[model samples]
Target: MNVAFFLIPKKDIVYLKEKSTMRQALERMEYHSYSAVPLIDNDGKYVGTITEGDLLWKLKNTPGLTFHNTEDIHLSEVEQHVQNLPVTIDAQIEDLISRAVVQNFVPVVDDQQTFIGIVRRREMIEYCSQLLLQRKVE
Candidate 1:
């Protein structure tokens, strides 16, 4: 029941660096077709999650801030609406499922708190569905 079993490795995930520009975050999110993405620090630790809402809010509140000129805004400066917090690598599936209840993916990190991968809600649903079906069959 290790969470790693459900992990979508970091290599396949589009994540934002703490120092990346708001423009970079937007481009990466658009490229990956994701509404939210995990933000990692320079040391590879999970900082927080950045969502489309966070971006829009920043635009609406910040003076003179527009999509056309996001180069001056750093990702770190944009207030993040953090979703599911990260789970350690050794965390169980039960823990993953609980967190996925609130977010699309549960960010997984190592003992050092370094970003590793994510367990998507789709995977959690499939696992629970299979479990439920097995009970019905029994």
Candidate 2:
């Protein structure tokens, strides 16, 4: 299947700009109910990913840090150990499943290599369930 069919379009994704603060990132994650989110540069390039674990680490490492103080910290300042999973607009469902297993979400970029969208684990599971149900009916 076309990766685009399974991908959550960039418009539907909850991403954080490079300049966004940890607090803002946290809020977005909470609002979207996502464990991790993709990070994009000013030009809308895919930079990396930030996770709930990264936020926890930041909170623990920076004792007494406040939202006001987070301005001093950029998304780039926080080290994100993100997986560089293969991103292809034509990726197969099996390929997506493999990538999703390793990384909760795989970042999707356009032909220009611009940040586009993501394929979440939950989305994959839901898709698989639907496919199985359809198979059973057939």
Candidate 3:
């Protein structure tokens, strides 16, 4: 099956711009109640995934940095603790499943590495569950 079968299109997803501040990331994550969110470039390419842990580490490691000063910290300066590698839109279900094992959501990109959407783990589990049920019913 095509990877797009499990995609949650980018249009429906919340993402941060590459140049956005860490403060912006925190605010967006808070509003959406998501621990992690995808990072997109100015050209709309998938860059990486940023999580609450990354922010925490940044705050902990940066000397004299406070929440109030987060606005001055750009997303580019913060290292993503986890880089959930993106898969092409045409990737197979097997490939998606492998990546899903490590990521809550797998980033989906086009041939040119343009950000397109994501394949969530819950969706993959449900798809696998349905497949198994069908086999049993056969």
Best by TM-score: 3
TM-score comparison, 1 vs 3, better candidate = 3
Which 10-residue span in candidate 3 carries the lowest summed lDDT? 1-10
Q: Please write out the lDDT profile of model 2 over residues 1-138, one tens digit for every residue.
A: 778887788998688897888878877888888788888999988888888888778767887877667666777777776654648777778888888778888888887778889888888999999999999999
Which residue runs of candidate 1 sit more than 4 Å off their true CA positions? none
lDDT tens readout by residue for model 1, 1-138: 898789999999888887988888888888889999999999999998999889999999999988888878888999976666999989999898888878999999998999999999999999999999999999
Global CA lDDT computed for model 3 = 0.93
Candidate 3 positional error at 128, Å: 0.3
TM-score of each: 0.95, 0.83, 0.97
Residue-wise C-alpha lDDT for candidate 3, range 25-106, written one tens digit per residue: 9999999999999999999989999999999999999999999999999998999989899999999999989988989999
Q: How many clashes in candidate 2?
A: 0
Model 3 clash pairs are none
> What local distance difference test score does each model get?
0.90, 0.81, 0.93
Model 2 stretches with alpha carbons more than 4 Å out: 63-68, 84-86
